[model samples]
Target: MENEQKTYRIDGFSCANCAKTFEKNVKNIKSVENAEVNFGASKITITGDATVQQIEKAGAFEKLKVVDKNQPKPEKQSFFKKHREVLISGLFMLLGFALIIINDGQNAITTGTFLISIIIGGYQMFWTGINNLSKLRFDMKTLMTIAVIGAALIGEWPEAAVVVVLFAVSESLERYSMEKARASIQSLMEIAPNTAVIKTPAGNKELPVEDVRIGDIMIIKPGDKLSMDGVIQSGSTNINQAAITGEALPAPKSAGDDVFAGTLNQSGYLEVEVTKNNEDTTLAKIIQLVEEAQQERAPAQHFVDQFAKYYTPAIMVAALLVAIIPPLLFGASWATWVYQGLAVLVVGCPCALVISTPIAIVSAIGNAANRGVLIKGGVYLETIGQSRTIAFDKTGTLTEGHPHVTDFMTYGDYDREAVLALSAALESKSEHPLAASILDFTESEDVEYSTIHIDDFKAETGKGITGTIDCKIYSIGKPENFDDADAYQSEGKTVMIIKENNTVIGLFAVIDPLRESSKAAIEKLHKMGSRTAMLTGDNEKTAGAIAGTLGIDTVYAGLMPEDKLDAIKNMQSDHKVTMVGDGINDAPALATADIGIAMGKGTDTALETADVALMGNDISQLPFTVNLSKRTLRIIKANITFSLVIKLIALLLVIPGWLTLWIAILSDIGATLIVALNGMRLLRVKE
Candidate 1:
């Protein structure tokens, strides 16, 4: 999450205006949690669940990539920067002391030094308070601004100078703490790789990835960052997509495999046909999502954001009460309360509450990323914990997308390879997962395949293939394609029986087996007071069997994309529906559900569509992260309430003259320290 107070580089930063403009630009990005542009360095680090697509659409950066390279870092002001204003005022105080030693307080040196110090430190307060007073904004700043000026007007210049300088120091410390809390979020820039070598027809040309565009042919050497989203057109390679999808195994790819923009090309050379425009590439989409996530406030966290808005103004009125009512009521000195009020005002800023929740969120997101999960934003974190319904894509999500031989009903004593080989020969040129799987299995056994009339063959979405073989009507498809009365499956996927001439052959079965941890995950979620359901495009038997085995509460099988979404909407009233899937076809359901949990190693579109990507294909972490979110929300609420209570108590004590400057400082700042320390506990959260 981008923390507004967090430091980031302002590209080509020339002055204060540039910093402000860059900050504003970054903030305008939908999911940008916060944008703090340091004018010193020409770089921008944006934090959020903003994907590259949104950013490219927003057009914020003419060209902005995260900057964490070992360039010579710029040197900011030393520890003495915040103390400079105080140092000048202190010099005046010392001058006044010299004058006092010579001829007493009435001397010109003493008078001049006192006047100078007061003017230097109290001017900002005077005008700011006047501004606030004009707005009918009876705030702490208004009271202190008037009080400090009054102190100087009455010849208490030294005291006035000390007050403002102290306030300045406290503000400085608050800023520093904020900087520390936002450190981890800055690491998000690493999501974009620095370089890319585009492949032109002439040869491989090395260029920065920023210059890449859509439809450009690119050659990837061994161990190269995939610079743009494209499909592999040539060469065989095993790519490590772990960073993008969190899978441990290297997926083998040949021609026609789509690779994402930010992933790694692990082994072998490859030529890719760019499928996505450069601006709308996968990497860009990730950045955009992160940014959006950061800007989106969690329901529980919003309380803190609003708390600071009122707390500051109320403290001002309380300060006035300390100055006015206390003197009138108890005949106590007005000066005492005035000083305490100033201290209260300084401590009352909502810096602590503002910093707490977002830090935890950013830390949690980072932690998830390290383990291969991509939680787009805090709002998703909030919803994930409450989601009760789980929708899944049959292939790649529950069952492996890679096809398998599920049945081999012998017809007239046909050999195993007899049907397998014939089907493989027909599907040898097909690109569908089941087709590829059949071909892979048959080819592995060195079964000879004779070319068939694949040109006439057509792939039916969610079903199977259809074509003529040897002048005989042949259809190889899901069991659902055949009459339900004619073919039936017990639990898992079953291939249908179709005749090449007349008599029926046998059925072949395949399944994308349940994720190794899915059953355990479902059980854990059930115990956590969440009802678990399954949504699939499989037949009644396969879906039902998987549901029963995993102890799922409900099952929706043989559903279309739209039907899945509509079913999710039906469950929306009483529960948050979490759709977990791993196919491009599941995109709509993923988008429609309360939480779109995408399997990381799924397709690029699925990865982008999902709200939370289970990075390693392990469904167990899904439940763990949800539980973590709930726990985090509780801690955040505690931090906010605790912070507010301390400040409120201190405010009461300040007006009644019961609390002094030291106690006020301790109360206001101590709560902040406590809140910040509590947020750091997120780093220790067990993943």
Candidate 2:
């Protein structure tokens, strides 16, 4: 049998500690090689000989059900069916309290009613405690059951009933908090419709998204949400991609342009040729990646996990000493000390501390995805918050990547047409961005150009290209390859030198305009105290001029692809660097930097290689992303501090026997609710 890796969705998997317990138990199984439980996503991924039966068995103690990822989870039981026992137990507790108030502690009926509440509310905890105690597994259920039984043994029936009711309420609130955190991710799934209108052999027909095939033509009317990824075959319209890319303005789309599923078509009728099925759509990929990002552990989350592992056991020992030492050694009153110890047990649960980091991370990642920012994981999100320096590629990053021909002059006996005709023919053979500008210029000028069969075509990165255009070899490159080229360089233009038979023929000056938002974004980064630099293959004059216009702090010009990587690595020694680019040449530097941010409109290689992707290729979102990261970190720290301080204060009360059952449970459960709400603040952060 071959080893296989499978992922299963888990239902009823809210407790963070229970997730760890399930992972540990699954790893201990003989056939399993490794197991990882993602609590935020409620999933378990395992690689080895593991079976669904084995996975279910590991989670049986927590009532967690393991099922296939694609399988519809068993329908959630109705509220009445699921919480019937909880309702009955609460009624019993109410009756018990009323009886005590009516009888004034003298009637047998009061004691009996209180006993009934204890039996109804405390039975499940006691059962779970016995099973766990037999296996030597200590958990919250075990601690609670022990505390309740000890209080009942010392003749404090009312206090025991109070403990049972409060613990049940605490569990309910914890489940509610987890469900609220998961709601943001679930909202993403509801954005796209389940059906689409596709053109069939007979006519236009409505079909389920799963039945829609690649190459099928989809008709999208104005106000309809797109149901599949495809390229426009005809018509023009504006698309609202705010759901996917977070670009606030409606982007105009024309013939042959790509549109993503779940985006709204705002104007004109569009006929699209489908390129991807429902599962492979960009919207689907974003949802899947966002869910996984929430599961990835950050450093603070890991620390809390380690802390809980020891914290629970140490608190159990402390409660035991409080109960036994005062009664046996100091001759303290047994009932009073025992009740205080039971209160300590209620306050010691690690519920708030464990969930503090993950809830904040999940909220931040989901929010970023909605705005068209894709943050891969919590670690990368946190790293971007700490980055001290950011290096940017000049073309397509700081400036509009498209360039236009400014001035062209023939140096030899050749006229403008003869030189440009040969230049356009040679440039047509290449796919570089500059080649497109040359082709556009020739078409605009109506130069009668003829295609020539070029032999031995070659290219030099950061320089230019060469090919055979006529009987003589022709070369098109930078101004440095020719003599007396200082005029164009001094004008801050990228001058392409044309040479044939070792003689200079012509010089073409071109300039790519800077992006409108570059200066504002750079100024914002500066205000945030982050240094910025520009790395480019353009000559020093051109690169320096563009950098100066945008107020960039440093410029590294005349660089090859490898040279850009070296520049990033050199900067890494002094400060954490963020490389931003949108081309194949920018891939190395993007990967070499401490954090890589890629423009959304950049090449697919650059997008995949980058740590963070700006879907609209807008520089304005850069400062917003950095500010969001910083805010997420601050919120996480606040949650952790608040949880610890509340617990510290509750624990101090136990020293003077001042704590009561209600106050102790409130301390633990209240902190949990407050921290959860605090972490959710990141979801409302605006881009």
Worst 10 residues of 2 by lDDT: 601-610
* Overall lDDT per candidate, in order of appearance: 0.64, 0.82
Model 2 RMSD in Å is 3.1
lDDT string for model 2 (506-600, tens) is 88888888899999999999998889999988888888778878899999999988999999989999778888888356877888888899888
Model number with the top TM-score: 2
Task: Report how far residue 381 has shifted in candidate 2, in Å.
Answer: 1.0
Cα lDDT tens digits for candidate 1, 1-687 = 334332333322222222343456567777687655432123345666555455333323222334334464456667666457657766776677677777755665677777787667556556646765776754434545665665655565655665565544444454454444334434434654656677787878876666777777888888887877888889888887766665667888889988877677778889998777655775565554655565566776566546655766676666666567766897877776556655566556455555567656655665565456777778888788767666666677765566666555646766766677677766775676667666766777788767555446776766666666666666676554455423335556545554455455656566566667777887888878888777776678877777888788888887766888888888887878888877366777788888888876535555567788875676767777777777777777788788777777876775445765456545655676676667667656664
The positional error of residue 438 in candidate 2, measured at the CA in angstroms, is 1.2
Cα TM-score of candidate 2? 0.91
